[model samples]
Structure formats: C-alpha cells, structure tokens
Target: MILEIIIEEMSKIVSTIPYLVKYKKHRLTLDDLSTLANDSWLNDQVINMYGELIMESADSKVHFLNSFFHKQLMDKGYEGVKRWTKQVDLFSKRLLLVPVHLEVHWCLVTADFLKKTVILYDSQGIGLQKVARNIVKYLLKEAKEKKQSAFEMGWTVSSNEEIPQQTNENDCGVFILEYSRCLALSEPLHFLQKDTPKIRKRIYKELCDRTLHKKG
Candidate 1:
C-alpha cells in the first residue's frame, strides 16, 4: 500500500514539473494530472526510491532533472516520438528515478534528427563531488581504451573552493586528450581537438601491446 501511494504521488509530481518551470505558462491542474494517468507510455513501476525523491523536490535544479529524463528516454528508445504531449508525459515518468541533488536538464539541440543533450549540474553541497570525479575518470579511461576522443566529454563541478577546471593539467584528476578529425571516424570525440600525433601514436602502441600480450 505504501508503494502504491508513492507511485501515485510521484506521477502527480512529475506531471506537474513542466508547469512549474519558469518557461511554462499553464499551471498543472487536476485535469492535467488526470490526463497523465490515462497515458499509456508512462511507466507505473517504481524502480528506484532515490529517483522518486529527486522528482518530487521542488528545489531541485533544472539541469539534473533534465539530464536524468533525457537518459531515460534515450535508453527506452522514445526519442523519436512526434507528439509533444506524449514526450512530456514520458519524460515525467522517466525523471522520477533521479537523485534530487543533481540538477539535470535535457535539450533538443537539433530538431532535424532529434539530437538531444543531457546536462547535469552538481551543487557543491552534497556528496556528489566524488561521484562527478569518478564519472570523469571512467569516461576518460573508456575513451582511451576504445581509441575514442575524450575532449568533448567533460563535466563541471560548482563548489566554494578553487576547484580545478582543467582536467588535463591536474595530476590527481583525469585529463582528456584531444584527437584529430583524421583519427575520429564517427561523431568527433570531445577531446579530439587536444591530442597531438605523438600522443595518439603512444596510445595506439600501448593498446596494441596490451592486446598482443593478452593473446599470448
């Protein structure tokens, strides 16, 4: 019974988010919530309790919420839906799982092919600082192993102290080495612009050596 109430309250909170945003004109009324209950795409199951907290918090920043929704929609393959109302409803349902401290935002950068970007803003207050650092390291390691560009892939943590903004120069943190267009076949990796030929060659050689060693 508790779980059921949580789901019901979550649904109401999510359905009302767009209206609560600064840009939205129409206030989410009882009729609006009823409309959401009737939607088929909205997920009724509550998978994560932390996500439910993020969705319900009125003080939650926009960026974190948006990022969570964008990832959820993309993972579910619902990015190409034609109707705005449906998309909004779907977004609300997916956003219920994000932790409240991370300010998430999603934007449709290009309408022609449905290119969406998810931005996450981490306030310096919570325990998110370490999580952000870990994410950066993981992304960098993955890019290096795959021979992908890591330049464009980066994150920013806002805090009171003088935090290191440049990842490449920091020893304790991760650095993104840029790649050249010639090296990147698909969408340019974020760090493609910062890599030199020497660095690329060294990485390639190390990867090849590791592969050969594994096979041997």
Candidate 2:
C-alpha cells in the first residue's frame, strides 16, 4: 500500500499541466511544477508563487519579496532595486518575507517590523550574518529614501540556529517554504526534516488549489 501511494503521488507530480497555478501576477508553468518532484531543486517561479499564497494567507500582513529581490539588492546595491518598492510601504507591513537564493541554495530572511528584527533562516545551519546585516542596511536606506527619516536602529539581525534543518542538499528549497509558511501564520516550527515529503505534497496541492492549507 505504501508503494502504491508513493507511485500515485509521483504520478500526480508528473501529470501536472502547464500553467497549473497563477498567483500574484506570476504564472507557474509545467517547469515550475516539476520542481516539486522527488529530490528536485525548486525554481524561482515556484518559490514566488508560494510566497503569494503565504501573503494571502497572512491576510496581506506579510509582504513577500520575490526570489530576485535579494539577488538584485546584493548585486547592485539598494539603488538597483529602489524601484521595486516604489509604491509599497514596507514599514507599514507587519512582516517582510525575503527569499534568498545563494547560487545553488535557498534560504529565507524575514524582517519583523514590530519586533525590530531581521532574521536569517537557513536549513544548512550556516550563520549568514552578512545577509542579515545587508537587509538591515537596506531597511535603513529604504527608510531614508522613502520616509525621509531613519529606520529604527539597533534591530536584532542574526541567524536562527534552533530551527529544524535539512539532512540533504535538495530539500533546502522545501525547508525554506515550510519555514516561511510557519512564520507567516504565526505558528510554531514544529515540523521536522522527515515531514518534507508530506510538506512537498501539501505545497503542490496548495498551488493547484490556489489556497494555503490551514492546519487546525
């Protein structure tokens, strides 16, 4: 029965047609859907699409930065991505979810305005203090440029070492998605690395249904 169930799920993952889900002006095609397959590294489109779901589920209180946001900010500095938030007031949001893609790995950085924190969530258990610092610096610059004032100083910027970690290379993307979901919903990070297979299916279904699954 277990083997049959696994096969069934794999079939579903393989059978998804192109443009299966479209959210937040981003269209998820077959290529993106396939990334959810067994052990496959997820692409930018899937991450961004799921981010849209997270924002919706958070009642729009969470502002999700696209997968490219960090890359642009780090590559060209804040000026390169200044227009990214032209009409949006990031400080007005309760949380900012920034998905960080470092070459081949995926991680998350969340800016909590209420708590005055910029945290890095990496499944590899690496301390990315520089990434956190850059985000904090960006927030300061953004405040000066948009609000004509300074952002709150002395914000806590550090990596979260206590969170669940991945045992394999390919699951980092999935781990990032789960971490983002838990944080956005204000839920405890009770999930484990073993739960990733189930989590991946949940994410795929959520994408197909255009809604985030709320656990009761």
Whole-model lDDT values for every prediction: 0.25, 0.85
TM-score for each model? 0.21, 0.89
Candidate 1: Cα lDDT at 211: 18
Clashing pairs in 2: none
RMSD (Cα, Å) of model 2: 3.2
lDDT of 1 at 63: 13
CA lDDT, candidate 2, residue 193: 82
- Model 1: per-residue lDDT, tens digit, 118-187? 2222222223344334333433443344455632254343322222122221111011111111111122
Q: For model 1, what is the error of residue 180's alpha carbon versus the real structure, in angstroms, after optimal superposition? A: 33
Clashes of each: 21, 0
Instruction: Point out where model 2 deviates above 4 Å.
Output: 1-18, 148-152
Cα deviation at 84, candidate 2, in Å, is 0.8
The lDDT of model 2 is 0.85
Instruction: For residues 157-200, write the lDDT of model 2, one tens digit per residue.
Output: 88999999999999999999999999999999998888887888
- Tell me the lDDT of candidate 1: 0.25
- Residue 173, candidate 2: alpha-carbon lDDT: 94
Question: Which stretch of 10 consecutive residues in model 1 shows the poorest summed lDDT?
Answer: 105-114
